[model samples]
Target chain A: MTTQQLTQQIRIKKSFLCIGLDVDLTKIPQHLLELEDPIFEFNKAIIDATHDLCISYKPNTAFYEAYGIKGWQSLQKTINYINEKYPEIFTIADAKRGDIGNTSTMYAKAFFQDLNFDSVTVAPYMGKDSVEPFLAFNDKHTIMLALTSNEGAFDFQTLQTNGTRGEAELSGAKELYKQVLETSKTWKNAQNLMYVVGATKAEYFTEIRKIVPDSFLLVPGVGAQGGSLSEVCKYGMNTNIGLLINSSRGIIYASNGTDFAEKAREEALKMQQEMQQILK
Target chain B: MTTQQLTQQIRIKKSFLCIGLDVDLTKIPQHLLELEDPIFEFNKAIIDATHDLCISYKPNTAFYEAYGIKGWQSLQKTINYINEKYPEIFTIADAKRGDIGNTSTMYAKAFFQDLNFDSVTVAPYMGKDSVEPFLAFNDKHTIMLALTSNEGAFDFQTLQTNGTRGEAELSGAKELYKQVLETSKTWKNAQNLMYVVGATKAEYFTEIRKIVPDSFLLVPGVGAQGGSLSEVCKYGMNTNIGLLINSSRGIIYASNGTDFAEKAREEALKMQQEMQQILK
Candidate 1:
């Protein structure tokens, strides 16, 4: 989906919420386990229950991959379902994948061509060539990791780097995440770039806005990770409302009873209502 | 496999040569396409032909992930074949995956537990918590990317960072990759940690050795990417011959004809002989 289409969906839904379909079979309702593909069944229910409450759905690949071949099949089914049922809604494959140039193309094909996700998250540690392959796909998006929500985010993302200067001249040092953002903009077809900046670091959003004001940011640390939606929206929202606040465990696992899907919708509804108020 | 076990295998084989199984369908012989599982068939042939010449097999996940379900099946079968048939050989899942703490555990489980790889490559951008989970597994190694063998590596990995000195200590600034190596050593299961230092950067290995002298370095770029074997061995090798030098396309795709497996063995044999001489 294009930026204009995503922006329109946010306005229509009155929520830039992206529900993370991080389905864990063990965590779902006990009754679902009896099904052939419990993961897909659970995701189908959640998507059906909460599709209207959010503009996007993100399925973190790790959750599916943990189950092996069965997991990959579930992922394929989930993506196919989303594309067929709600093609208007943006889909993000939260697969933090990156490699050398040629290998990265295969990954791009996997997520964008094969799986048909509108966007896929990518790690920036390998730099330009690693990310450029994903960006090369027209109309598809590459969400590069910036300041993540985890405790480990501070380990290297925030470290001060001398910004292409020699070792001796670290006078105007920028944090590594900022350097990543700045350097990435100069790559080929960088206009297709988006970013993954955790909602937990809402304060960083103001600074991040100065660097790439127009690019969309997929914020993950909102619900279970304890990031406040209001604070994130307050600082991160651009003219086009270029912020996708993601809530994974908080919404999906709201209740593990037979009414699991219904309860998930309730949680999603609360967030959407809050977003409606914020949009006003 | 434990580090000691891996070390012993290197000595026993007199070759730390790791063949990367990055199988692209188009690149493989057309005849294999007629088979039910061409990728698995191709990988089985390569593994059968070249097992004696190499100490380890590193199958990059991207090549498998591209083909969707069938690709994933191939990957599972290939790993199973290696573990059951060549139990002595170390296995590396070149899936450079990393995420937040809890999510990272799932990825660790995906590669280590579910897929049952002896070692898996992880990107270190997310820091300690993201990596420490992978380390939590017994007898499994977490190979973190230190310096990659690509043009993009220069874009971020080599940037001068003021060593955690509150952005003021510009005088003693170190490159980002070195800081990664230093920081990773302090994590919980430091003993289980290895590193990915590209063979293209042979000169950087001397500096890397100072920080991680004992830890194994899984060096790629030796064959297809134009990195030297002797230079990497000379500077990167430790007392335990701590290097798993990888050659993917250079060996596996040596010839796409019917004699592909035999040609691949010949190529691997040449590298193994070179490594054997280096051991002398």
Candidate 2:
């Protein structure tokens, strides 16, 4: 999925929300647990209820992985359902994957070819080879991690590097994250590459947008994590409405009652409505 | 697995090698493709044949994830088999995962809780929040990608950030990777934290080791990618012999014939021999 297509979807839907399917069996309605695959059962309802309200559906790999083989099967079923029923909606395998070259190529095949997700979130610390393999796939998008919203983010990401004076003098004064954004953009055009910027750090958006104006930002932590939608949209939105604000537990587990699906839709609608106002 | 335990196993086995289970259906022997689960069968055969020759088994998640539900199942069976049969051998879920806080917590659950891998590769681009969640698990190790062996690694990892004006400002002139290593170490003392430094980038090892002398490093891209094993060991090795050199295609897919497992064992033996010398 190119940045242009993602922007088109956002504009068409009048929404920039990506409903995260961090489906945990323990958190879902107790009734669904009776089914052979509770995770899939819960995901089916959530997707069916909120399909139209969202431009993208992010199935975090961890949630499915928790249940072992059964969990992985649920993940496959959910993605297959979305692909067959709502082909228009973009899908993201919120699997933060990256590795060496040949290994990464296999990973690219797993998410892009086997699972059929439009994009997969990737970690950039392994440098380029671990990530570029994901980018090599023409149609698939690779969302690199940028400024994240977490207390520990201050640990190393913001630290200063001690490079030789000769190399340091040329690149100008850029923070570590800024250099990552700038350098990652050079791997490919900003077309297939997007970035995961946490909603809590919306203040950094102004500076981030300046670095990669056209790239889509997959912003998580909005609903349940206490990140404000208004703040994220204010600084993060681009001309293409380049923002995928994700709400996982806030929407998926909004109501653990029998009307879980309905409650999910209500929660999604609430965010979508706010996003609609922001896009306008 | 801790560096001491890993080194102990390496010493006992007289090997510093880690056999990478990057099992691809196309690359495996044709006969295995006829089995109920081809990837798992291939991996099982390779493990059975080469368990005595190596100290660790690193399964690149991409190969498993590419096959969808079945692929993930194979991954589980392979890991479970290794953990149960060879409790001493370290297991690495070569799934480079890193994301925002909540999302990262889920990823940690996937690999650590559900899958039961000893370590997982993570990207440090999003700063602490994206990575700290993975480090929270006391038993499991979080292998952050420090410097990769791919062409794109040069893109962002080596890019020069702004430094002080006249004097070589160690405070200001930080490469993105240097910051990641330094900051990530402080997250959870160096105990559960490791870095993925490519074997190809041996030159940078002296500097990297200076900053992170105690942390373990999972070095990939050695045989098939042409990364020098000796150079990597010379500079990258820590006081604890903190290095796990991974060789995937060059070892696992060394042969496509019916004696694939035997061939894999032979290839593993060759690398293990070299690693044994390096450890000495």
Candidate 3:
């Protein structure tokens, strides 16, 4: 998926909502568990019902991984279902993976080549060599962790970055997330890079925009996390409207009854309507 | 396994060497490809040949993930084989994973409960909440990435973190890794924590030791990555002799021919001998 194609999809659908298919067995309808692959069956229903209302589907790898080999197979089936049916919709394998260079190359092959996700989320604590391998794949995207949407974000991402570079006379330390934004742009194939900036940090988006004006941002705090969609758009919307606002629990787990897929579709429609209004 | 048991094993064997099982198809003996599960067969042979030499087996998740379901099953088989045959040997899933609290809990279950790994590596980019879930598992351990051995470590870990609390007039930013160590100590269940300090940055150990005096560190980059074993022990060693020096390529891919397992055993034996001298 190219940058232009994603932008085109957002405009055509009049929505930039990226629904997170983070399915939990306990949370899904009780009837679905009788199936051989309950997770995939539940995801299939949800995707079939709400595919047109959203531009992307993000399957959080942790949820699938909790069940072991069966969980991995369900994940494979869910992704295959998406790609085969909705080829136009973008896909994200929300696996927060990063390692050393050679190992990272293997991961790139896993998601981008074999599993065939358009993008995968990566944690950037290991630095350039860990990330460059993912960026090297032009057709694929690497969504990096910049400022996460959790309370722990303040613990490290927002810390002031000072001292190590020398020059005390220089301006005060830049925040860690800001430092990440600036440093990562200079790396190899950074053009293929996008950042994960929580939508809850709408205030920070104004400043974040100053650093990464052109690159798309995958924002995850819009619905269940108490982030205002309007506020995020006010500060985050670029010329291409470079934002992929995500909603997981608020959309997928809308109800536990057999009408779960219908409820999910209703919730997605509400979000799509709001996005349509904003895109106007 | 508990920390005491691990330390005892190190002393009993007179070695703290950790052999990384990062299997790749192209690098393994070509004959194994004909087997029903080549990766598992290869890992089984390596484990059989060198089980007594090293204290721990660190299988990087990326290598297994690249092969998809087959790769994941191979990983399951390898871990099961190690636990069944050599129950006393410590196991490390060198998977650099971290996420929000709830999601991380699933990951903890995936690695510790389902797969039955003693420890799993996690990245600290998401802060305390992300790491706390992993720490919550009492019988298991969480090894956080600190100063990595790769060249990219300089990109962020070493940067000075300068930020202030409200009216606190906080001091200038400490190095990112130091901040991680200090902040992580204050979190709940921090006793289950270890850290990854790359052997390539052996000189940083003196400063690192002051921050984490008793915690065991999983150190990579001993042989293949140009790290000196003697230099790593000089500053990083604790009274408990807390260090697990890892060598992936140097041990596993020692030879591409049919003598691969023997060559791998020879390399691991060399590391074990060196570690014995250091322990003395």
lDDT digits (tens) for residues A15-42 of candidate 1: 9999999998879999999999999999
What local lDDT score does residue A231 receive in model 3, on the 0 to 100 scale? 93
On a 0 to 1 TM-score scale, where does candidate 1 land against the true structure?
Answer: 0.98
Model 3 spans with C-alpha error above 4 angstroms: A163-172, B163-172
Per-model root-mean-square deviation over C-alphas: 1.6, 3.3, 1.4
Q: Name model 2 segments beyond 4 Å from true.
A: A1-12, A156-171, B160-173, B278-280
| Cα lDDT tens digits for candidate 3, A1-280 | 8989999999999999999989899999999999999999999999999999999999999999899999999999999999999999899999999998999999999999889999999988889999999999999999999999998998888877763553333234678888888889999999999999998889999999999999999999888888999999999999999999999999899999999999999999999999999999
Candidate 3 lDDT for residue B130 = 95
Model 2 C-alpha lDDT per residue in residues A1-280, reported as the tens digit of each score: 5667777888888888898888876788999888898888888899999988999999988777767778888888989999999998999998777766777788788889888999988876666676778888988899887766666555544444333233444355555566678767767534678898888877889999999998789998786677999998889887777788888888888899999999989999998889888877
Cα lDDT of all candidates, in order? 0.92, 0.80, 0.92
For model 1, chain A alone compared with the true chain A gives a TM-score of 0.97
Docking quality (DockQ) for each candidate: 0.78, 0.46, 0.75
Ranking by DockQ: 1, 3, 2
Interface RMSD of each: 1.3, 4.2, 1.5
- TM-scores, all models, native as reference: 0.98, 0.90, 0.98
What is the per-residue lDDT of model 2 for residues B66-134, given as tens digits with 9 covering 90 to 100? Answer: 787888888889999999999999999877776667677878888888888988887776667777788
**Cα lDDT tens digits for candidate 3, B43-157:** 9999999989889999999999999999999999999999999999999999899999999999999999999999999999999999999999998999999999998888888
Q: Please state the error at residue B182 of candidate 3 in Å.
A: 0.7
